[model samples]
Target: MSESLKNKTVRGVGWSFVDNIASSGVTFLVGLVLARLLTPAEYGIMAMIAIFIAVSNSIVDSGFSNALIRKVRVERVDYNTVFYFNLAVSVLLYVLLFLASPSISVFFKEPELVKVTRVIGSVLVINALAIIPRTVFVRDVNFKTQTKVSLISSVSSGAVGIVMALSGMGVWSLVGQQLSRQSLNSLFLWVYCKWKPSLEFSIESFRELFGFGSKLLLSGLLSTVYQNVYYIIIGRFYSSSLLGQYTRAEQFNMIFSSNLTSVVQRVSYPVLSSIQEDPKRLREAYRKVIKTTMLITFACMLGLAAVAKPLIVILIGEKWLPSVYFLQIICFSGMLYPLHAINLNILQVKGRSDLFLKLEVIKRIIAIAPILIGVFYGIEYMLWGSVFTAFISYFLNSHYSARLIDYPTMDQMKDILPTFFISSIVAFFMWCVSLFDISAYILLPMQLSLGILLAFIIYEKLRLPEYLEVRQLVCSLLHRKNKLDNKQIWTKN
Candidate 1:
């Protein structure tokens, strides 16, 4: 990699982490408050409509932002075309959702969904207005601006959600949160981003971009549908309260798993795309990314699982305790998400969205078995079944990576298994400590310290490269921060 690209990647990674951590942290704190203020069934109500919102959002993008990012020579008309296309699609979809809200309510046997759907469905259009700005920032690898946007949005919306929840708004507080967050996020992106679309729409640009993006659209649609299919099944076949428990588990798992994966995926995609032509550089970079991703993702996901019980009890109260088992199993499944995401990103970097779509089709087909398990057996079996599917999907996702970049499954596993092994040991130790008859306040801290201490010892002894890299990154960041602080103090004086 060139020195410039290396520096950009490093800076992008730092800001991306800050963006996700700060934004997700605020969102999480708000969720904790709302979870306490609300009932399980209330969360379930929001989860029930989450599928529609997710699918609509996916369709709104239709993978165009990715296409725009992947395109090396993006034109002004291209941005304008995609902006109009996305906004138009979002509007159409919202209308469809508005019309279909009644049926959605009927299917779930929850009459409240009709109004919630219309209100939250507006976010699709609101989000569309900011897609171009967000995409522009991402393509430029400008996550610093994004961090500012996300912090402001999350803080503002979280305050709104908390106030509403405290006002005893029930499930509507969740709806209010979603609306406020998206609206603020879109508004801030416009404020920070200077890109304004012109009145030009180019069919040539549309066709060119869509040629690459359409396959991703299909793949994204499949992925989105299946991802939320669990909510659909649980909402339809099971009770809303149970679905709420399931949603809580998934949310907790996502806080670490999805956010970490996203931070890596967002920055890695643009960086990897830039070097896609150089086979040797690409493969080496790919290896480092997979290892580093697993190193962090495995420890966090498994550690969260280890402290799942006490964490849930202390943070959201004891009523959410049922989510503990579901969270543990889901964390195992979530741990593999980075591997899955990175592999897919490789295909996109290679301009193999056709292959990407095929993989999604196959994986979603296989994913159906888990949905059946949830429908017939239970949610636990469903979550376990998901773990099995995640492993299978990893192999499937890696197939093209091995073919394209020579980083085969065995090689990848050999690289990541050490981290996984160490993480599992720490988790097991924490879980054992958690089983003791102790207060959650003490037990949570004890398990956390023990997990960290064990991981530090293992990594210090092994002298793993990924660990060393992370250590260096943390120290470098802190040193730079301290220097800036000192400089600011001197300037003031």
Candidate 2:
């Protein structure tokens, strides 16, 4: 990579890390408190509408944000056109959701969701208003501004949610929390992002962008629906309390899997897009990204699985113990999430949304087995099926990377398996520790600390390439910060 591109990648990774870490940390903490205060059925009611909201939000953007990001150059008219288009689509979807809310309640058998869906579905419009600005920031690889916006919104909305829960608002507390967070996020994005839409909308611009984006639209819809289909199945087939347990388990797994995937995907997509023309550079950059992403992902996911029992019981109380089994099973599947994401990102950055859509269609077709497993057998069997599908999807996604970048699936697995093996050993050791006859309060922290320390020691001893690279990256960042601090002091003197 060129020095300029490398610098942008480094800075983008730094701020994206800050954004996910701070924002997710606050959100996780607030959720723990809410879990303590609210019942599992309440969370299940909230979970029932997640798919609708996600699908609607996906339609609102209609893949235009990605199209804009991938384009070599964007015009003001393009932004205006996408903004107006998204706004109109969001309004239309909101109305449809509002009218369909009762049916959604009937499907879930949760009459409470009739009101909840209408209230929470409004985030589609609220989030649509911010899509263009957020996309612009992402295209520029400007995550520093995003870090500020996310942090403020996360902290502010968390405060409001906790207060509402304290006031005994029940499920409305979750409703209020979702509305406040998205509203604050949009407000802050507009405040920080100075771009405003013009009255002019260009059909030409829309056509140009949408031509590249339409396949992505279908691809995104397929992926979104299947991703949230578990929620749908659980809410429809299982009790609300059981679905609530699954939601909590899924959240724990997401803290590591989804957050890390988002950070890497957001930073890598724009960076890779900028260098898409240089196949050698793109391959090199992508290889590094996948390795580093998997290094963290494997360690976090397996480690979380190892500690799932004590962590859930301690954080949310014994009432949520059922979530422990769910979380452990889900973590096995979650470990592969970043690998799946990075492989697909190659197709996106290469402007092969046709292939991307094809992949999604194939994956969703295979996903039916898991859905059936849940419906027929049980939720645990469904999760085990998810683990099965995840590995299959990884192979399918990596097959394209071989054709596109000459990085074969086996080679990619070879690069990542060392870290996975090391992480598995560490996790096994931690699980052994958990077998001790001790209080969970003692066991949780001990397992966490020892697991981390052992992993570090083994990685250092093995001199693993990804581990050393991450260490060097951290050192370079610290060295850069110290120089800036010294420069400031020298100027003051």
Candidate 3:
């Protein structure tokens, strides 16, 4: 990689890391308070409407934001076209969802979801408005602005959610949180991003983008639907309270998996895309990203799994104990999510949305049987099925990456397996520690510290390239910070 691109990638990762930590931390805290305040049934109501909001947002985006990012030369017409298209789709989808909310409520046997769905679905419109501007930031590798936007949105929205929960708003508090975040995110993006759409909308530009993006649109819609299918099944077949427990468990898992994966994938895609034409460099860069992502995310997921019990009991109380096992099981699946994401990103980087869609179809097909079988058995069965699917999905996601740049599934696995094995061993040790009859407050911290310390010690002893690279990256960042501080002091003097 060029030094400029390398530096951009590092800076992008830095901002993304800070953004995710701050945003996820605030959301995690707010969720803890809300879990204490609201019942599982209330959270289940929010979970019930989650699919509608997710699917609507996906349709509104229609993969155009990615198309914009992937395009080497973006025209003003492309921006205007995507902007208008997203706006129209968002409005139409929201209206459709509004009208269909009653049917959804009926399907889930939850009468309260009718209004909740409509209120939360409004976020699609707010989200749609910000797509163009956000795409600009991402395409430019300008994550600093994105970080500020996320921090502001997360903090403000979390505060609103907490206040509303305290004021007895129940599920509406969750809805308010969603709305506030999206509204603020859009508002901030507009204020920060100077780009604006003109009255012009070009059919040619639309077709150009759509030609590449339509497959992604289908793939995204399918992926979104598949991801949320469990919620639908649980909500429909089981009790709302049960679904709420599952949702809470998934949320805890996601606080680590999703945020960390977002940080790596967001930085990896644009940086990798910048070097797509050079197979040698692309392969090398891709491997490094995979190793680094695996190292960090593996440790996180496994460590969180080991500490799930004590952490859940201490943070959210005993009422959420049922979610502990669920969280643990899901974290196993979450460990490979960054791998899945970054592999898929390689396809996008190589402009193979067709292969991307094809892979999605195949994986989703493979996923269906496991999910169906699990549903017949039980929730735990379904979760174990998810673990099965996650492993399978990794190979499927990496198949094209191998063919494209010779970074095959087995090669990628070999690169990541050491980190995975070491982390797993450390996590098991942590779990053993947790078995002691100690206070959850004490046990949680102990497990975290020991797991982290052991993982670091093992990595250092192994002299793993990825671990050393990460250490160097941190040291370089600190060095640069000190130099900048010294220069600022001199200037002030």
lDDT values of the candidates?
0.92, 0.92, 0.88
For model 2, how does the per-residue alpha-carbon lDDT over 224-330 read when each residue is reduced to its tens digit?
Answer: 99989999999999899999999999999989999999999899999999889999999999999988889999999999999999999899999999999999999
Off by over 4 Å in 2: 483-493
TM-score of each: 0.99, 0.98, 0.97
Candidate 3, residue 170: CA error in Å?
A: 0.9
Pick by TM-score: 1 or 3, better one: 1
- Compare the candidates by TM-score and give the number of the best one: 1
| Residue pairs with backbone atoms closer than 3 Å in model 2 (clashes) | none
Clashes of each: 0, 0, 0
lDDT score, residue 103, model 2?
Answer: 94
> How big is the positional error of residue 260 in model 2, measured in Å on the Cα after superposition?
0.6
| Rank by TM-score (best first) | 1, 2, 3
- For candidate 1, the per-residue lDDT at 34 reads 90
Where is model 2 poorest over a 10-residue stretch in terms of lDDT?
472-481
Write down the RMSD of all candidates, one decimal each.
Answer: 0.9, 1.3, 1.4
- Judged by whole-model lDDT over C-alpha atoms, candidate 1 comes out at 0.92
Error of 1 at 20 (Å): 0.7
Higher lDDT: candidate 2 or 3? Answer: 2
Question: Could you tell me the lDDT of residue 174 within candidate 2?
Answer: 89
